[model samples]
Target: MLAPTGWSGRFWARTECSFDGAGKGSCTTGDCGTGGMECKGNGAAPPATLAEFTLAGPASAKDYYDVSLVDGYNLPMMVDARGGAGGCASTGCVADLSRRCPSELRVGDACRSACEAFGKPEFCCSGAYANPTTCRPSVYSQMFKSACPQSYSYAFDDSTSTFTCSGADYTITFCPESAPR
Candidate 1:
């Protein structure tokens, strides 16, 4: 698919899906709740791995991307940048968080973030804990960071999690080490 210049969007894969001829179905993980193959502009449910992007725009003049587990984690993913300048580094989370998932955060093949599991302001980085200073990483977020150093473990994990590039193409690979070629 050719994304026009300045296009911005996110992508993810749904696991354990079942669809009929009419294209209606649900997935065990990353279900957008649209009840169909197409998400129809709907976002994925929690515990779904995501590859987010904001292509070069007038305001920034550079592309930004990240693999975020702030919502949760369902699988391993990696983002590679090709032919770009200005910190065009590869970034992603290739760690299988499911095996290391805490008991409280485990959801079948997925792992819920602290915010998704408890909805606490501290975990969600909301209210008084909206900023980086007030919302230090919790034990749960710390664990995620320790496992997936390149992923956005919490809401304020910007310095390392977010990456930038200019005039580059990106490849988002799910389960990068083992995905079918």
Candidate 2:
């Protein structure tokens, strides 16, 4: 069994069929075949002329969010969310989205909104999610130093962890990859 990281499935390898008589049905992501198996140049390379499996390396960080990726895997999800890959950690933690949002937003105004969805950022470093600054109240920093000491990034694009201030709506893509289908 394979574990989840972030890669989509392997591209379907094409197979070489001979027009040596009987017609068989075949097609790729794009063009559909004619009376016989027509390799209609579907953009991707055709199938292998031989039978073999090419094991690729681990899935990249983005693939996990695509519909085609993580197709076969039974993911761990929030109990109530059901087969839908529940919770932000499971289904909502993607990086790319079909839509783009402003890199920054004011705390009170609505920033990025997709349909009915809205992104209101939160300082993950608050309270239990924050750290103690003991002898230091670095006025230079609004964020309590040593707070959220570990989780501060979404690795793929290497962007900073977004935050929304009190009484503000921050502009951020609502999810990791995209909106829930």
Candidate 3:
């Protein structure tokens, strides 16, 4: 789908889905909880790989984007900027994190973030740990970062995870292949 020049949105893949002729059904992963094929402005359920984008707008000259596993991870995903200037590098988590997901965070085919699994302030980066200085990466987020250095392993990983570009289009690829690290 095409978005306007200044459009901002997120995208993700849905797995193990079944929809009837009326476009009503659910997906095992990234369902969006709308109970239908269309998300209807609903965000994906947790344990999903997300590709978020904020296109250039009046207040900003550059576009910002990232492949985030902060909510968790269900699959490998990548985002590439095409024909952009300044920091148009590719970024993603092509690694299959589910294979190495911690036992407590494992959910069938997906992996839950530490925050989702425990709901602690340290893991969720909330309450007392709501800032970049206070919300440091935990062991689980560290492991995620080790596996996917370009992905948003935690909420405060903006420095290394977020990318920027100007005057370009993006291509989000699910299950992108890259040489093993």
lDDT of 1 at 22: 98
TM, every model: 0.94, 0.16, 0.95
- Candidate 1's TM-score: 0.94
TM-score of 3: 0.95
lDDT order, best first, reads: 3, 1, 2
Residue-wise C-alpha lDDT for candidate 3, range 1-181, written one tens digit per residue = 7777788889999898999999889998898998998898999988899999988888999999999999999999988899989969899999988889999999997999999899999999999999999999999999999999989999999999999999887898888766232
lDDT of the structure predicted as candidate 3: 0.91
Q: Summarize candidate 1's per-residue lDDT along 16-61 as a digit string, tens digits.
A: 8999999988999899999999999999898888899999877788
Q: What is the number of backbone collisions in each predicted candidate, taken in the order shown?
A: 0, 9, 0
Residue 115, model 2, lDDT: 11
TM-score winner: 3
Task: Report the lDDT tens digits of candidate 2 across residue range 87-128.
Answer: 212212232211222333211211112111222122222333
Deviation in Å, model 2, residue 84 alpha carbon:
6.9
